[model samples]
Target: MNRSHELQLLSLEMQNELFRILDFWSKKAIDSEFGGFVGRINAAGEVVPKASKGAVLNTRLLWTFSATYRKTSNELYRTMADRAYDYLLDYFWDKEDGGLFWECDYQGKPINTRKQAYGQGFGVYAFSEYFLATGNKESLAYARELFALLEEKYRDPEFEGYIEALSADWQLMEDMRLSPKDANSPKSMNTHLHILEPYTNLYRAWPNEKLKERILVLIKLFQKRIIDPKTGHFNLFFDRNWTVQSEIVSYGHDIEGAWLLHEAALETDETEVIQSVRQSALKLVEVTSNEGTDTDGSVWYEKEGDQIDKDRHWWVQAEAMVGLMDAWEITNDDWYFQGLQKAWEYIRANLLDTQNGEWFWSVDDQGNPNAKEDKVGFWKCPYHNSRALIELISRINKLKI
Candidate 1:
């Protein structure tokens, strides 16, 4: 078979595999025992009852299934999305506190009540899309509320960026850690990326004037502060005044941001923004090509100086495929298309757990999938991989039509 035909067949097979896993997890992962989804499921498909549930996982579940339902017109997918949406509103959202909680207990109580802007941004992201799917004004209003909260409390009027986290009552907190590895920075690429994400979704539903400007500014923030002009990799952490604060370079985030920044620009519809974003994205594609990719078609997690953690993360590969595909679409380059196909082949060959329903979170340098990462957990859900498959299928289908 020729190369084009080979890629078409491979993408078709990947789409089928992705839908199968989504169907399996949609049925198996729901928390009929408590509510929403069960807190954790290991590599063996064993549920961990004692694990505390996370807002990020549940919100992402709602968004993925909701988007899938819209894409496929599948009632089963819609049902799953509704379940997650109800659970998020009922359990995770802090009605009095004005944003979503960080974590929840097993029985659906608010355990980690701090308002992480990233989590709230995702809440808005999911709910706004849910509004589009179901026309639920309640969802739209809630999404807008979260948007306002982020702007009012987290956004820096003078400094031109969002703060990382706030206490339950909206006070700035001393401990601003998103994950243990992340530094306690007032601003972070992680938070800003997600904030941009939800704002894009909200604009789709509402199209408010202020929202549009904020989104425009966010793209500029990336160009001005986050993205390294020389290398195209985003600086992970930043001080309150937008000074670079971290040395670690996250390959996954670089690739993920490449596509997201493009989307932000495209969705905004400003010619200058799109032009600028297109330029930055091209540079990012080159940087990841040089520094991130391995000879095995996998991308590493990150590097701290000479210390390279060579583990191929599940989400990183998923994002890399989409980003490479985005690059191909933007530049019409054969190399980017080749890179997308190669990444998908690597994912199918190694990252996918055929016995289990989902992917292994990490894989070794030799392409052995890491067995320790849970199949379902606070950090792992159907979002990244499912979105990757949906994106690939849609883009190819659009191309065909």
Candidate 2:
């Protein structure tokens, strides 16, 4: 097939998968007795209604449905977006303290009220998308509110980047871990990367001077503190003084950050920053493509020293596709296009749960899907895969190839 025909075919496949994802979440993931979506669903498609709802999950649901509604003009998607928005406001939003709670009970009551900067970033991201889709001034106001909260509560004036977690009253917490898997540190690249993402999206909706300035700082942070200039991989954990803490390499975050940083620079419309970030993004993508990808085109989960995590995670492969495609767009290189095709092939062949709806958490090095992880949970959501599809479709459509 010609390049145009190939892109058309890929676009069709991506659109179909995007809708399939929306259908699965809309039908299977809703909590009828409670508000918002259920907290957990197993790989077997059974809903765990009693599971504690997470701010990340709910906010991502808000973003997916809101973005889908904007793309398709489907009232079904709009309805889902509305459900997420109401649930977020009524349950997740901390009325007394301000900002969002990290977790809520199955019944929509506050459980873990700690304010995670990562979760707050997602709040801004979801709310801004919601505003864009519906032109709801309330959504825009809420997004702006979250942005202000981040700036006021999370920003470290003594240091450059934002803090990881805070107490219910917005005091700095001793244990600032985002999860048990993460290092207990004052700052994390993951949190900062996510903050940059939502801030960029929020800037697009609002375009306020403060937001623009914050986005520029975040872009510079990626270029300096978070990413290793020599290695091109992000330093996973850090102290308050910007001291690097961990040596782990997360391929997913590396690829995701590449595109995200580029997007942020583009949104800023600063020529110098854009030029610098473009080069940095290319290097990040190159490193990930070289060291992180398996022979079958699947991205490994992470690496620590010589001990490589060969598992092909669902989100990693999803982001790899988008990242590689972004690289292809930037360089007009056939190698990056092939890399994208390979990642998509790996996803379809291994990661996607053809029998059950949605994706597997990950597949092992041998291509066996791990059944232990929750299909839908705090860390697992439709955002990465669905957004990748949305991005790919839009990018491919714009390609003259």
Candidate 3:
């Protein structure tokens, strides 16, 4: 097929996959007895009704449905987004505290009331998208409120980047870990990356001068602190003074950041920053494509020194496809295009669960699905894969193939 034909085919495929994802989540993940969506659904397709609901899952659901509604004008998607938005404000929003609580019970009561910066970022992201979808002034107001809250509560004046976690009342917490698997450090690449992502989205919706200034600060944080100049890989964890705390390389974050950084720069509309980040984005993509990808085009989970995690996670592969296609757009490189194709092939063969709906959590090195992980959970949501499909469809259509 010609290059134009190839892109057209890819766009159609991505659109189909995007709708399939929306259909799966809308039908399977909704909560009937309890408001909003269920917290956990096992690999056996059973909902764990009593599972503690996470801010991330709910916020992502809000963003996905809102964005889908915006794209398709589907009233069902709008209804779902409205349900998520109401649940978020009614249950997750700490009205007195001003930021979202980390987790809530199935009955929509706060369980873990810690204010995670990552969760706050997603809150802004979802709310802004909801506003764009429905032109709801309240949603936009809440989004702007969250943005201000993050700036006031999470931003460390002594340090450049935001803190990881705080108490429900916005007090500093000793254990600032996002999860048990993460390092208990004051700073993390994950939190800062998410913050940058939402800020960019918020800027698209609001375009305030202060938001623009903060977005530039986040871009600089990536340039100076998070990304290693010597190696393109990101330093996973950090101390308060911007000290690198861990030698771990999270492949998912790297590829995700590769494009996110570029998008942030693009949002700024500054020629100099855009030109600089364009180069940095390609380098990050190059490193990930070289060291992180398996032979079958699946991205490895992470690497600490020589100890490489061979698990091919669903999110990692999802991000890899977008990031690689992003690189292809920047450089018009056929290699990156091939990488994108390979990633799609691997995802269709391995990551996607044919019998069950939606993508699996991950597959082992040998391409065996990890059945132990929850299919829908706090960390596992429709955001990455769904966004990837939407992103690929949009990006491919823009390519002058």
Against the correct fold, how does model 3 do in TM-score?
0.98
Q: Candidate 2, residues 1-401: lDDT per residue as tens digits? A: 88899899999998998998888999989899887899999878888759999999999999999998998899999999999999999998988888999999899888899999999999999999999999999999999999999998899999889999999998878888999989999999999999999999998899999899999999888888989977989999999999999999999999999999999999999999989998999898999989998878888989999999998888999999988988888898999999999888888888778778899999888888898998999989999999999999988888776
Give Cα distance to truth, residue 164, candidate 2, Å: 0.6
**Candidate 3 per-residue lDDT over residues 112-213, each given as its tens digit:** 999999999999999999999999999999999999999998898998889999999888999999999999999999999999999999998999999999
Q: Best to worst by TM-score, what's the order?
A: 2, 3, 1
Write down the TM-score of every candidate: 0.97, 0.99, 0.98
As a whole number from 0 to 100, the lDDT of residue 67 in candidate 3 is 87
Q: Candidate 1, residues 1-58: lDDT per residue as tens digits?
A: 7756765786688679778878767877978878888989988889987789998999
RMSD of 1: 1.3
Q: Candidate 1: misplaced stretches above 4 Å?
A: 2-7
- lDDT against the true structure, per candidate, is 0.88, 0.91, 0.91
User: Against the correct fold, how does model 1 do in TM-score?
Assistant: 0.97
